[model samples]
Structure formats: C-alpha cells, structure tokens
Target chain A: MELKNLGEFNFIHSIESDTIYDPNTVVQGIGDDCAVYKVTEGYEQLVSTDTMVEGVHFSFQYMMPYDVGYRLMTANLSDIAAMGGIPRQVVLSVAAPGHIDTRILEEIYRGVKEQCQHYHVNLIGGDTVSIDGPMVWTITIIGEIPQGKAVLRSGAQPGDVVGVTNYIGYAATGLGSLSYNLDGYPMTRIGHQRPEPQIELGITLRELGVHSMNDISDGLSSELNEIAKSSRVSIIIDETLIPLHEETYKLAEALQTNPIDYALLGGEDFQLVFTAPKELSKALENLGSITLIGEVIEGEPVVQSVTKAKEIRLLEAKGYNHFHE
Target chain B: MELKNLGEFNFIHSIESDTIYDPNTVVQGIGDDCAVYKVTEGYEQLVSTDTMVEGVHFSFQYMMPYDVGYRLMTANLSDIAAMGGIPRQVVLSVAAPGHIDTRILEEIYRGVKEQCQHYHVNLIGGDTVSIDGPMVWTITIIGEIPQGKAVLRSGAQPGDVVGVTNYIGYAATGLGSLSYNLDGYPMTRIGHQRPEPQIELGITLRELGVHSMNDISDGLSSELNEIAKSSRVSIIIDETLIPLHEETYKLAEALQTNPIDYALLGGEDFQLVFTAPKELSKALENLGSITLIGEVIEGEPVVQSVTKAKEIRLLEAKGYNHFHE
Candidate 1:
C-alpha cells in the first residue's frame, strides 16, 4: 500500500522496532520527543550530517531502496570514521512522497537498522514527513573519540607522506558498468552500490600517528585538495602509485576509458586517506592494503599529478559537486 | 544568480562564519568531517530531528525565506524543550533545486543563525545538496538535561491535571488571515510565522514537577491524544477552559468559524502542554499564563471533549498527519 493510505503514524508504528543494543546507555529510544542517553565522561562528541535525494544523489535506475539506505548510512558514517571516532547514536529525517510505497520505506529502514546494528549505533529518534517531491533521507550521526585525538583536515604538513586504504576507482567503474549494462565485474558494481565506511581503518591510522585524515567520498581529488587547502600545503601524487581494482582496470579497458579519471572524478568511495610522518612508512606498509600514494610538499596549496614517464601536470582539485554541472 | 551558477563550495564559503560560542567545549565546528565537542559529565544527552518541505510543511506565499528558517528552527527547538532540556548544538541538511536563487538560501541561513545565536545553540555542521525537487531542510538538534530529569510523554498518570501555557489557536487564525488577506490581526499572522520555543518555561515547568509534557506543534488534539495513548490514560478537556487569544476570537467571529476548532485542529502553536499533580494547580496558575484545560481519568485511552452546554463527544485522536490526507 502507498504511504498516503497507511498514514504517517501507522507507517511509523509499522516500521518501529525494539532494536536498542545497549539499555544502560540508551535511556529511551524511538518513541519520544527527544532521545535521552548517558554521555561517557572524558570523551569528546563528534557530529556530522549527510543527505541523499532521489534522482539527484541516487536513483532506482542504479540502486534499490535497500541500497539507497545502505549507501546513505555509509556516507554519513564515513565522516565519523574520517574524524577517528566511534559512532554511538544516530537520528534520521526521511521525507518521501506520499505516493511512494510503504514497503519501500520498510526496506529502507531495514537497511538502516541492520547497518546501525552492525556498528552498535542506536537508532534513537527520527522525523518522517510526507512530501510531494523526490524522497530524501538525512542522517545525523553522533560519535565519540578520546579528547584531543581527532585528526583534522588542517593537520597535514610539509614532508608528510600521504596514504590511502584499498584500491580507488572501483566505485566509479561500478557506476559505469551498471549504467551501461556491461557484463561481468560484479565487484565493481557492488562497490558502487555498497561502499563500506572504513571505521576500523580510521582507528588504526590514528593509532599509527597519522597527522591528517579524510574519507574519499567525493573522489580522491576533492579529498586531496581539501587537505592541501586546509593545511596550507601542496600535494603531488604519483599516477603509477594510485591503485585501481582489477575489475576497474578490466572494465576501463573494455570501455576504452582512462581509469585514472574514475579515481579522480568519480566519488562514493568510502575509503580512508591520511598523511603521516615519513618515518612511519615501514610500519604503515606492514599494515596490508595501505598504499603510499603521494607526498605533502611546501608550495601553493594545489594538487599536481606526476607520471612515471617523468611528465607532470596540474590536476584540478574539482570533483563530483552537486551544484556544479 | 541560481545556486548552480554559484557552485556548492563557493556557496558554502560565502555562508561560512567563525561563530564559536565556547572554544573550550567546541574543539572543532564547521569545515570538519564532524563537529567535535567535549561532553558534559553526569548529564544525559537529548537528540531529535525535524524536517520541512517547501510545499508540504510550508509555502513561500505564507512565509518569507527568513520566516521559513525561523519557524523551522523553532519547530526543532520545541522538541528539545518538550524534553525539558537545553538545546546546545544543531546540524542542518538542506536540499534545494539547482534553479533556486542563492540569495534565498542566504536569507534562510541568516534567520537560522540569528535564532540559534539567541538560544546559544551552535550551528556546527551541515550538508547542502542540489536537487531536482523542491527545497527541503532538516535540522538535527543536540541537547542535554540533568540525569533522569527529562519529562516524557508517558509520565502522565490517572488524576493528573492537564494544563497548557499561554494560548492556542492563534496560529490557525493567523494562517487564515494570511490566506484570505484579512485585515486587523497582525498578531495572528506573526504567530503563524514566528512561533517561539518555550525553553525557559519548560525548565520552570519541570522544576514545578510536571509529570508529562509535549509541545503543541501538531495542535492540542494530537498532543492530548499522544499523551493519553502513551500514558495509557483517558483525558477530558473542557471547551470553556480551552484558552484562545482575543485576536483569535475576533478573527474567528469575522470568519464565522468556531475558535475551538482552530485550537483543536490547527497546529504550529509551539506551546507547551503538561500534566501535574492536582496539588500543583495553584502553583501552576500563580505562574501566570498557565491554563487548566483537562484532567486525566481512569478509563480506556481515549480523548473526549465536553462543551460549556454540558454535552460530551468523543474527539478523534488524530491531527495533522502528513500522509493521512
């Protein structure tokens, strides 16, 4: 049945669950004006919000309702991960068209609930409104970190080594594969639909004394430029050092597309990127899948790409921006 | 110019402010992956979110950009006040069509910033996205209250006295005035456009030992019905005791409509309704502007209304549901 027929209160009751993970910390959940919970002493709180709108951020042409919810949560949680914090609570605001199916909302909530449960984050309180526009979901996450331990975008410094977790360009290729109905490359397609937040990697990087950090949400270019601008330092990344998933390389070859473009321009890669002192390079390498991709240098805060063939060119720090065509 | 021409990062930079209320607690604010702040010890945190859509929750015809932002914040803050908590920080997620004028967005932010500044609430972090749909804004608020002291909707008990602050029905009449371009009722129009969050009054009511409380954002009918259902108690409200502003009565008389219908069905009042022990009525009344409206009784959880003519009728326990229509 459509949501308009179900009614707001009925839809909420239909999807509400007894899903509190920790009763001691959560005094109340789901059914209240505001969720009241205990705050741990000596900890700093981290808060961030992310929004996804139908036909703008994602569409059913590329993702299911479950995938939409899953990816939206991942995008929001990645911000917490980027800050080297552990997510504890979340509140959601969902606005869907009244003509939308109630089951779609249920599936969306299921994805949200399962992901939050996996991370031990409480789904505390939310607002659900019926709208006449495309469906949108906004998640505000609360996380906690040890006081004075949050990695900042401005913490990168000259002589620091820049690194990333896992291969880039996978999600972009995944989007391409799905859009064009390309065969094979199941991993690349999954990457586009189910980007995973690198929470544990963030904690590890913090422990390794990483100076600065960000999640590659709007592609590597935006992340690198933001760090450079915030830290007032320049970054030079080696094109050869940038890793691409095997599926991404294969799909790029089949489509005759430069894989590097995907890594630079395609977003939705919820992977961790950080800069640390050069001396920790050996230790970082010991940790599997950590790629030393670039160096922070003393210059104007701009990003330049250098090829192994000794050619160098300035790379635009622009990425997939919603307001920029 | 439209937001598409201005671009997302440029728009963000234009609106970015260095407004930090307390540096000691706020380690980081805007321009970070997540806002970081020190958590207060021995206190419980309160969190809630609210959403407003351009055509569903409001319209530009009845409100300017400033009023939209102002009323949106008030609606969210009222939830925090309903829990007897002091609002501390807020994060916003705004999605607007790329065709929208950037100046409208600037005006909206100005209103939000001014209102937040007045309440000492920090606008720490938010997401701004371009969509192909109507403008939508979601605000997630973080508040804190003394441990175990927050009022809940389920705290009302049998024999508790129900009371409301100030008056109700002004906003509906105000909406009516704006809709028909009626003259001679400026207060009602302002009331509809600018409902204030009763934070101080909430604290006072909590100290005066209010059992259960709600903010009348969805009118008295919804508030009373929710309280009754949550507390598993019956409520009987007297028609004569339902307070109405003098302006509301005049507008209703001019329009030839029942003022009580406005109080019962028209929402956006942002007034507080609470229940207290019978002995506290004198204290509550002495506080000024508090009206005794109803009494909780032992019966099936239903809401009923009695007229001054001594006739009783079952009041439908529903109000202002977005999907119900």
Candidate 2:
C-alpha cells in the first residue's frame, strides 16, 4: 500500500504496535512528543547517531530493505559497543519518497524489530517524513554504562597490546563477491549484509581493563589510526599476525587484488580493535577469538605495518572519507 | 570550498571547534564513536528526534542553510520542552549531496552553534554522509527532568484550563508572505525562519501544576485534539480568545482567507499549549504572554470551537501529513 493511502497516523500506529515492550526503563514510548526513560542511578548515558542514504550507503539493487534496516541498526549498536556500554533504547528518523510501497517499510521494521529483540533494546520514538529525495535512515541509540566504566579512545599507553576481536577482510570480500556475482562464498555475502557488533566482547574487554577501543567501520587501518591519534601513541603491527579468512584470500586472488589491502583498507568490518596492557594478553586470549596484532609505543600518532621479512612500511592515514569518496 | 576538498575528517574537526562546551554533564563530545554524558541522579531522560529534508521541510530558495539548521534544532528542542524537560545534549546526522559547497555546511553549523549556546545545550557526536539525494538533517536531543515532574499529554483533568504560551498563526503568515513576497510581515517571516521553543515556559507551567502540555507544531486544532485524545477528555475553545498577530489577519484578508483558519490549522508555530487547574488561573495569567483559550471537560475525546455568536463547531484533527502533502 502507498503511504498516502495508509495515512501517516495509521502508519505510526502500525509501528507502535510492532514495537517491543520494555516496561523497565521506558516511562513512555510512542504517542508522545518525546520518549521518556528513567536513568538508573550511578550510570552514565551513551548516545550515537548514524545515517544511511540510499545509493550512497547501499543500493536497492544490491540490498534488500530488511538488510538495509538491519545494517543501520548494527552500525549504531556497534558505536555503543565501542564505548563498552549496553544499548537500551533507540529512536529512528526515516525519509522516503512517496513512490515507494509501504510494505518495504514493514520489512525494514521487521529487520529492526529482530535486531532490537536480539539486542534487548527498545524502539522508543522517531519521526517519519516523505521526501522527493532518496530514502534516508538515521538512528540514534541511547545506552548506559556504570559511571567511570565507559572506555574512551584516548587511554592507550606505551607497551599496550593492540588486538582485534575477530578476522578482518571478510566484509570487503563479501562486497566483492556480490559485485562480481561469484558463485561461492555465501558466508562472505552474509558478512557484508549483516555485520555483527561485538557488544559482549566490548564489555568483557572493558571488564578486563582494556585501555582503548574502537569499532572498525572505516577499515582496520583507519580505526587503529584513530586510536593512535586519540591516545597520542604510535602503533606497529606485524603483517603475519593479522588474521584473514581463507575465503577472503581466495576472493582477493580471483579479483587480482591483495587480500592485505582488503584487511587494511576495506570498510564496514565492524570488528573491535582495542589496546590493553601486556599482562592481560592471557586473559584476553581466554575470552574468545582475539588476535594480538601490534603494540603501542611513545612516538608520533602514526600506524606502521611490519612485513614478514621485518621490513617496516608506514601505512597511509587513508580510508573511506565520505566526502572525498 | 567544496566538501570534497575539505574532506570528512576536517569537516568534522570544523564542527568540533564550533561545539559549545558543557563541563558538567558532557563527558565526551564530537570525535568519539559515541558521545558520553553523565546523567544526574533522580532525573528521567527525555529523547526526541526530528528530521528535515531539503525540498520537503525547507527549500534553499526560501531558507538559508543557517536557518535550516536553526529550525531543525528548534523542532527538536520544542519536543523536549513539551515534556517540561531541560535539553542538555544533541547528536545530529546529516546527509548531503557531494556537489554542495562546504561553506554552506559551515553556515549550518554556525547556526547550530548559535542555538546551542543560546539554549546552553551541547552538540555531541554525530555522523555525516555523502548522498546522491537532497540534504537531510536529523537531530536527537537528550534532556532531563526530575522524576514524576514531566508534563504528559495524558494528564489533563476535567475543569483544567487550556492555555497557550504565545500568539499563534504567525508562522503560517510568514510562509504566506514568503510565497507571495508580501511586505509588512517581516516578523512573521522571522517567525517561520527561526522559531523559539518555549522551554522556560514549559518548566514554569510544570511547576505551577499544569496537568498536560504539548508544543503547537501541528496547528491549534490538531494539538488540542491530541491532548483531548490522550487525556480522554473533551476540550472547548472560544474562538475569540485565540491570540493572533494583527498582520496575520491583514495577510489572511488580503489573500481572501479567514484569519481563524490560519490560527486553527497552521503548523510550525512552536508555541506551547497546556492544561492547568482552574485555581492556578491567576498564576497562569501572570506568566507573560499566556492566553487561556479553552477548558477541558469529562467526555469523549473531541475538540469543539465556540463562536462569538454561540455556535459550536467540531474541529477536525487535520494537520500537515508529509505523505499526503
């Protein structure tokens, strides 16, 4: 059904009914000018917003509406996770052209609902607008962490171990598979479509006294550079320590590109990169699939990659800049 | 300079410098993956998000980029004000076409900074994306109010007086003036371009035991209908009591339309409409520029307007629907 035929109020009502109930924190959700929530004592609040514009962030030809919504929520959830906070509430703002069918929004909301249920976050309040421009989805997530427990990007210190939560380069390889329509690599396609946020891993790292952390939304190199710049430290990573899925290397070979390039420069991996003191290496390894990739040193805020042969190469501070791209 | 030349990181740096500092609640602002704030104890949090699309919400031919930013912030602030909450922090998500000039965004941020400083709200973290579509601005405001002090739309009681904070219909007249190039309505034009949210007034009303409140963004009739429905009460307004600017009448007469229509149906006024007990009538009257225009009665949710000639007319709940428009 067309949105005009469904009417804005009724459409909002549909969303209200679809929203998951959260009686504990939510004082009031939809049907009000603002969503009200009771903040627990001794907790600090975390907020992050992300926008996805059709044709810029994703193409309808390549992404289902459900995938689009799921990816948008994942991006916001990842930001909260990067801070070692538990995401609790979200508000979304959506703008779409009138020519689109309303069922697409339902599918999108379904994806959103699935994510919210899985993450135990409430869809509190949001606004919807009809525009002549392409569809744009923006979500603001509200999360919480115990006072003084939230981590920042400026805490890394010299001799701290730089580690990542999981294998990198899979998301880029997934995009490549879809772009080339490769027959195999279903996992890579799923990786690109539904990147997971390491929420539990982030909390565990924070509890384990990790110094600084960031989510790899703009490639591993850019995230590491951010941590280094914020903490005013230099980081040196060994190329041989970096973990890559075997399929990623196979896809890189098929595309005649270096798999290392995808691991370092490709974006939207959503893996966690963090720094912790050397003593915590055993504890960090015991948690899960974390790999120690580098160490922090007192120097200019830069990232350098050491080759397997012990040759040092300075990595350019370049990644996906939305404007420059 | 074009945004392409400025680049995303530098653009974000520009915004970071423009941000107003708040040392108490803001733990971190721009540049982090997520902004962090320390919520004071015994306060409930209020969150509201609003989106403005370039062609749909404002046209560049009519609105300067600075005004666009200012107005977008105003809309979100008004939502918080409706709940009698003190807005503290905001996160913005912006998507713009790559061809746009970078200076336009600078101007937009300048206006945002101006509002933040004026309101004492901090600009926190946000995301910027390049789109192939029209510019879209979405802002999420975080606010706080003492527990149990938030004025909701469902709290109006029978015999409560319905009051408005300021004069109405000026914004509609402003749009009329801009559309027709009508002179002698500069104030109305300014009203449309830069609305002032009634944040202080809302707090005062809440202190005075005002039962319910809402911002008049969707015309007096629609706002009254919302309160009536939410509070499960009928409201009767005397048409002659509505405070409208003299110039609004002049413009309405010149355009061969009833001035009352604008007062009843115009959108984007950003004035506060509230319900308070009758015993507080004198205190309400003392508040500057307030006008009591109606009374709540125990009945079905409906809004009826009483003419000077003693004729009663049912007011339809009609307002701007983006999809229908």
Candidate 3:
C-alpha cells in the first residue's frame, strides 16, 4: 500500500476513477495534459486557489484524511459562494512524502470526489508529486457567474443590513474541545470537520440582488472588516445579536471561554455573511433562518460592536495569520 | 527579514504589488476572495496545474528563487502550448517555512510577475500559507483556444510524420552536468533552468493542421509514446535523425554517453513534439528548424527506435517517476 511500491502509471490511473460529475462540460478530463472545458455562453469566470499545509491548517490527530480533503474543497468552494458564482471545476495539486500509504491518499481523494459530486463540480486533471515533507493539498477552482452578476464585497452600501446564515462559533468551539474529546458534542465537531459550502444560498442571493457577500472562514470580525474596507463604509453590530448554536454555548462553558470570542476570532465556519438592503430583510428570512445582526453606516471603514450597556468597542481583525500562527 | 518577523497583511501586500498584467481581462484580481475575469468570446478554456517541491523538482544549490518561479511558470505554460492554446491567467499557491527570508519570496514573486508580463498573462489571486516543511509552489494556469481547434494527441493518422521542435537533449544533458558543479556546460545549465514554452510554434502548428501535439517535458520517447497510445498507432524513429544542440553533443561526448540516450530517456526539454501529414513537410519546413525524425504506422501503440547499426529497440518510459524515484 505504500506509495513507493506503487508505480507511476498505476498511481495516476488509480485516482482518475469516477471523478467527473458532468461529462458534458469536460472535453478531456484526467488523461490529458490540460483539461479542456467549455464555459456556458454569457457567463463570466471565477478562479481561486486554496492551500492546506499539514499541521498549519489541520492536524492528523484531530482530522482523518477524509476530513482534510473535504475541508480543503469546502474552503475553496466557499470562495465561489462569496462571489455568487457557480463552481464548475477544480484541479488539484497534491504532494506527500513518499513513505505514506497510497490508501490514505485514496481516502482523501474519495472525500474530494464525494464532495465534488455533492456540489456538482467536475474533478478535472491535476498534478501529483512526491516530496520530503508533510502532505500538502492545493486546489485551483473555476466557477461561473452570469455576465456582470458577481456580488463583490465592495458593493455593500450604507443602509444595507448585514445578515448571516445559520449559526457561527461552533467550529471554533468544537476545535477547542478536541483535546479533551469524550464524544460530548458531535454537531459542533461536524461544524469544524465537514462544513458544507453555501452554494445554494449564494445563487439565490445573487438572484435576490444582495449588495455584497462574504463567506465566514476567518471569523466574523475578519469577514466584517474585509467587507467594510472593500466598500469604504463602516458597520455596527450588537454583540448579543451574533447567533451561536446551543452546543457551542455548552462547549464554550465547558472550555471556560466566552462563545462570543469564538464568533469574533475563531474560523472554519463555512456559513455565509452578506449585506443587503434593509427592505429585503423579510424576503431573506423567508428563504432561510437568516439573522440580521448588523447595519452598514456612512463613515470610514471601521467595524464596531455594541455591548448590552450600549458601549462601543473596536472589532479588529485577529484572523488566522499564516506566518505568525 | 524572515517571514515570521514580517506580519501577514504586509506579506500579502508585498506580492500583490504590480502583479496584474492584462487589466482589461481581469475584472478583479488579487484583493478578492476569487479572481473574476472574462474569457474571449469565441474561445474555449484550458485548465492545468503544475507543482514544484523543494529538493524534489529543483534545489537551491542549482537554482535561485527567481529561476524556480520562472521555470515553474514555463512548465505550466508549456502544457497550454502543448494544447495549442494561449495562456491567459494563473493562480499560485505557495507554502514555505516561517524561517525562510521574506526577500527570497519577493524574488520568487518578482520572477512570476516578470514571466506573466512576458506571456501577457494576468497574475491573479493566490493563497500563501506557512508550513513546517519544504517549500512548495503550485500554479494553476488558464488558457484559451479557438473552439474545435485544439490539437489533441489522439489525432495522428497512420501515415503521419513525427516531428520535434528545437533541440531535445540539452535540458537532460544539462541536469546531468549539475552534480559536478563544473563550468563545463553552462548552456545545458541554462537549458535546465530557463527553458521557455513553445507557444508560437504550437499555435502555428495547429493552424498548419498538425494532427497531434505534446510538449517534450517527458523526453522524446515518452511524448512520442503518448501520442502513439492516444492515437492507436505505432511509431518508428531513427535515433540518428534526432536533433541535438552542438553543446549537447559535445557534453555527451565529454561525459562518455550517447546524446541519443538523453534524447530518448531524459526529460524536462519543454520542446514541442507533433505529428502531421507527411505531405505537409514542406509547409512545416517553412516554420523554422523542425526535425522530422519518425513516422507513424498502422499497428498497436508501441514505440521503437532504429539505431544507426540497423537494429530496432523498444523505447520504454524511463522518465521521472514521482513515487519510485
């Protein structure tokens, strides 16, 4: 099962199985040097790259190979969701130490295939290499949006209400519980390990003409700061208005840390956050359990949260820093 | 300064400087969640990925950071060239240890920027991460080709002629000379380090009705075998007719090996190899320095090289194997 014994052609042919979800869009898939694809007429293109380095992004002690591949794909897919684009294809580049088992890679790739099938994206051609280091996975994704319909973060305007789907902070809370894991909260653990991209909500929100959108991966504060700076506007949110799952609250109590801190600083929650006209609040609620927690204001790009006593505090970005962390 | 000393936002901003080349095509580039762009109206899309791991693909002793980036871009661009496409955009994902100097990364990005400018490609958004392992760079390239005009490796007919562009053995010959650290073959060193993609030749060959095409990254024998297997034909090449640079021949003689061995077995040439109608030989001759070294025949997919001493030998794929190597 070791990759060293698996010859090159066999190793390549192994992963080329059952990967493509839509044959119509792919002219050539895995066997070619480049995967030739056709974009639907009248659609603009969306491209993004996501990389996960072992021990930096995820730990094997906490996540299986399947979780790694699934989370990696979700991370990139969420970017397309933020753009209100339809993810169509992804090409992966994977490097692992030669001593690793090929079966572990097969499990990782299985996770990728199943997730791509869930999102209806094609697993196109990719490059695989051997390295003398920890395993690395990088996926370059391609998505499509109707011409000129991309909802950029810079489109947030004053009087827009910021809304978020589902709950946040559960992922971070779940991560904190991993060290003393005793099968306490499975839901929060799933929140961290297997979060799904909000592709359906993205498409519907684009149709609903949301002013701007962002995916919550690097915590609520970082996402809010990005939207504010890009739109050149200020935002105000009530700290108590931020939604947290019941499990998140219970887990945070067990860990002896405030759940709000997880909501503001911890990440890997694939929920979506968006700014839309305040008048469309009812319409957004009709689509799902959206929580309108903040308001955009006319000022410099700064995000502030109001406490219960109406005290304002600056919400600075403390997202995951690649080099420093 | 080490990347650890440099903060995250500053590190990202450093590479985002002057990275865009074609502003018209890029609706949004580096500062967004995903890069948004427009494909030319009548062209289909080409997607491919290439990866380079430190100590696996290249070494710091043999190549500087600039050379690494330049050569990495060239490798992916060559895939586009092989498909007879015009490369338009690229997204890179790079991971390095925190102790690596930030200036070294700047040099790498500068090299990527310069190469993108050379090819008129937009240096779009990418993900940069930190790892506790060897440096890795993954580039996902996008290209465009006129609809139904791409030359696949499966199009060669029975009577087609196998041709190669430029010299074939110099890169492999140069790589072999790297171990001695001698000034004996600087040309070969450059060949291994800075090989350019044959985009113009590929485009012209496609327009001139080349039936099949492949870039010579995996040696002449492996590329020809790929074409034969894809096209379901047998190929016979005269090893004597294989072209080599004067320096390549001299280096081979000095190293006490046949230049044809390198042409048949060694890789990383980045040259163009194609099959065209035998009657188009005169037309192909006008395209400068194309060597017609072989012929396609109606048989099973096998590659045989005829020696000058009137002996036929099977040319197996002894190219670089990711796992076994």
Residue A301 in model 1: shift from native, Å?
Answer: 1.0
Question: Residue A114 error for model 3, in Å?
Answer: 0.7
Candidate-wise lDDT, in order? 0.88, 0.88, 0.88
* Interface RMSD, per-candidate values to 1 decimal: 0.8, 1.1, 1.1
How high is the TM-score of chain A in model 2?
Answer: 0.97
Over B176-261, each residue of candidate 1 has an lDDT whose tens digit, in order, gives: 88888888889988999988899989989988889999999888988899999999999999988999998888888898988898
lDDT of 2 by residue, A1-325 (tens): 9887787787888888756545689888888889899877888899999998888888767678898888888988999999988989999988988878999998888878778888989999999998787889999999998888888999999999999988888899899888898978888788888888889998888889999999988888888999999999999999788889888989988989878888899888888999999999999888768999999999999999998789999887677888885
List candidate 3 segments past 4 Å from native.
none
Candidate 1: C-alpha lDDT: 0.88
Query: What tens-digit string does per-residue lDDT give for candidate 3 at B11-51?
Result: 99888878777888998888888989999988989999999
Once fitted onto the true fold, the runs of candidate 2 whose alpha carbons sit more than 4 angstroms away are none
Model 3 chain B poorest 10 in a row by lDDT: B175-184
**Where does candidate 1 clash, by residue pair?**
none
lDDT of 1 by residue, A48-116 (tens): 999988888888888888988888888888999998888888888899999998888888888788788
Complex DockQ, candidate 1? 0.86
